[model samples]
Target: MTEQNVRRRGGGKRKRQRGRGEQAMVPDAEFTSYYGRPVVKASPWQADIPAYLFLGGLAGGSSLLAAGADLAGLPRQRRSARLVASGAIAGSLFALIHDLGRPARFHHMLRVAKVTSPMSVGTWILSAYGPFNALATGGELLGLMPDPVRRSRPGRMLGVAGRPGGIVAALIAPAVASYTAVLLTDTATPSWHAAKRELPFVFVGSAAAASGGMGLVAGPLDESGPARNMAVGGAVLELGASRIMQHSMGIAAEPLRQGTAGTLHTAATALTATGALGAVAVRRSRIASALSGLALTAGSACTRFAMFHAGQASAHDPRYTVVPQRERRDRESSPT
Candidate 1:
């Protein structure tokens, strides 16, 4: 055969093969079977995690606030601070125990401390702080250590011992506020993992604001001033951090901005703002302080719920996983 004829035949055969392949290929829409499914399972973390987080933050922050008030020579503030601190500590312990799959195994968490694990660090912090806070508050409540200067050496020693623990707890409070975010961000939850930076700040601010609000409601006006300021500052930081979290993240931010999360976030924002404003006006009227404090507490709770919902939403959605994985694949395949 001639070269031209041979070329023609080969081209025709190639075209025919291409057509057959096209006809054999099935469209993705035609197959409605469950072929491609998500690989990772959604975390079954219950409400207890966030509740424990909030209580832990509150306990840590309140302890610091109480210590600060004590140092300031505000007896009423100190008493209120100690009471709140003790309550928060107890509540946190309860929540932590409740959340554990094996509540009895919780003691094993303190067998040894690991700096690499937030949970381990948290366990140690609680172990050390919980008992000390309980003892200090108990002493004050029972009037066993009253007038330490005039009391026996043991009473004076107890007061001295309490100071160091209080100081230690105060130092650890910021970490308690922020580390919960780290714990969540380190997880597979898309919304939380994507918000690694802002989440810590948000939690910290929320903790501070919540604790301060509690103190303001419980303490006298003069002593509550610093707590009020802390609350205001925390609210401002939280609002800003939340805005940044929503803006910086793309689709991942949807959980926080829409549906149930949106409602909670909105309520949190409004309550926090109202509480901050009320804090300023609280100096004029005790009633305003009480009302604002309540608002802030409610706001803090809403914020925690919103954060938890956002994480769950992110985990439940397939787009969050698929989009990131697809982008990563595309980047890897691209030429340098």
Candidate 2:
């Protein structure tokens, strides 16, 4: 055979070479095995997963904000932060339970602690955080747990135990916001895997901003100064991160710009921007605070749906998988 024929046959002369012969004989359609069984089924993850993720982040962020306010000598801010934090935590737990295919089986997740598994770590974090958050709120509600109890041996023990847990929750708050991104990244989902880095940052920022918005709405204006600042900062970060995500993802980011995902993303962006700006103007006004809070909550919810739909969109398109893999292989084979 001529040299041209050999090169056309994937640069091989052997007639019985399975690798080269397979590529040569099979059409692109046949080579792809697109007609075979699908690589992934529809995600078993329910809507509650997104809801719980958002709420858990809000709780954690609010707790941190409250702690900061308490340190700053803002009594009303501390109270509002504690109250909202507790509510968010409770709502998160409820959503988590509701999402489980077998709600009773959730205990199995805590049967063994595995650091390598995000789910396992998350379960432990929740287990440790839930009660402490509840107690903190309880203490605030019961008028600071009484001077005697605050200083007693049992009180000290409770304080010791609760303090560490609170700190852990605060530290984990950002992770809680971002880990859902990791979950989506590890999957076969196209949009998620493609924009892995940006997704996490966007979620984290949104959570923090949402939490700040809640604090602003619930607390007195003078006490809510920090929350307003935090909300503004978070909104700026989220907007920048999302823009980077869209630009970096190329065609895979199409879902984020179109269809249901597109609509939600646009709404989220608008609400987040509006609320952040409102925070500055309403730092002292209850009415402004209320509107900002509403916007932030709506924005956070829209973000979650946009993310979920983006993943679904990515998974539905075969080109997302095929084109990237082919390009990678081609690049690897080319000489420097």
Candidate 3:
């Protein structure tokens, strides 16, 4: 697997020259496969894959929002963000488990932590994330709301518990938000592997936009200043990054701009742009803010699905892998 000798070079077979003189420099590594098929297998993940990524990112954003609100003494924003984070993260866990074919297999993965595996590391991060979210959100809930048991010690403790609990969740939020991009890039999928440098930023931006949208939709206008700012900033970030790749990857970026993936991405970009603008214009109106937020949330979800399908599309086409390598090799061999 380490070496792929040339099949034919002009009229003669190639030789591997090593450490003797100025070695041949290639822009991209070369490889071959049976019958022009992919050298590596495509992922067997179902529809749940993108769904899981979407929720994982939403949870991460909410966790950060919660912690920031707490630190700034914005209790309402803090409480709501934490609660949303807990529920979203819990949902993400369900989706991840379902993808494993057998749900209990997830526990087996947890028995031994391996840093080498992104999946394992993500699980560990979630283990910490879930409990912190629970403590932060649940604690605040019982304290603030009318509970069946009046004057309970647990209820009394919950109010104060949210502060530190939220901090812990915040610490791991960005990792939870961005690691899925790394997981995808680590695979053999050409679209994913090629866009590794930009995908994480795209993902984080989506996450932030989504989290901010949820806050704006659910929380009061007076308390959601951070949410509004985040929504606009994140939409801009995601759109700009995706747009840059049009020229960056050349032919390889076509999968992101054509077929079903292209349609979905286009819709996402338009909706996010509209939402970003509307968020500023209608900042004072709760109804308008809610509408903008809803649009943003839908757009972010579509973006996740688009990226997921794009990777699958790239893997199915052989030219994506072969042609890029050939072009890179040719370019490298040419004079400066």
Q: Which one is best on lDDT?
A: 3
**lDDT agreement with native, every candidate:** 0.77, 0.76, 0.83
Instruction: In angstroms, give how far residue 1 of model 1 lies from its true place.
Output: 35
lDDT of 2 by residue, 292-331 (tens): 9778867887888888887787676666666667777999
If ranked by TM-score, best first, what sequence of candidates would result?
3, 1, 2
Number of clashing pairs per prediction, in order: 0, 0, 0
Index of the highest-TM-score prediction: 3
Question: C-alpha displacement of 233 in model 2, angstroms?
Answer: 0.8
Ten contiguous residues minimizing lDDT sum, candidate 3: 1-10
Which candidate order results from sorting by lDDT in descending order? 3, 1, 2
lDDT of 3: 0.83
Query: Residue-wise lDDT of candidate 3 within 1-336, one digit each (tens)?
Result: 122443232222334577675434443434445676775567799889899999999999988988887787788887788878888888888989999978788888889998988888888888878887887887777766776532577676766776788888899899999999888877888888888788898899999989988889877788989888888888899888877755666677889888989998999898898888889889789999999998888889999988888888888877678778888999999999
Error of 1 at 138 (Å): 3.1
Q: Cα RMSD (Å) between model 1 and the true structure?
A: 7.3
Clashing pairs in 1: none
Q: What is the TM-score of each candidate against the true structure?
A: 0.84, 0.82, 0.86
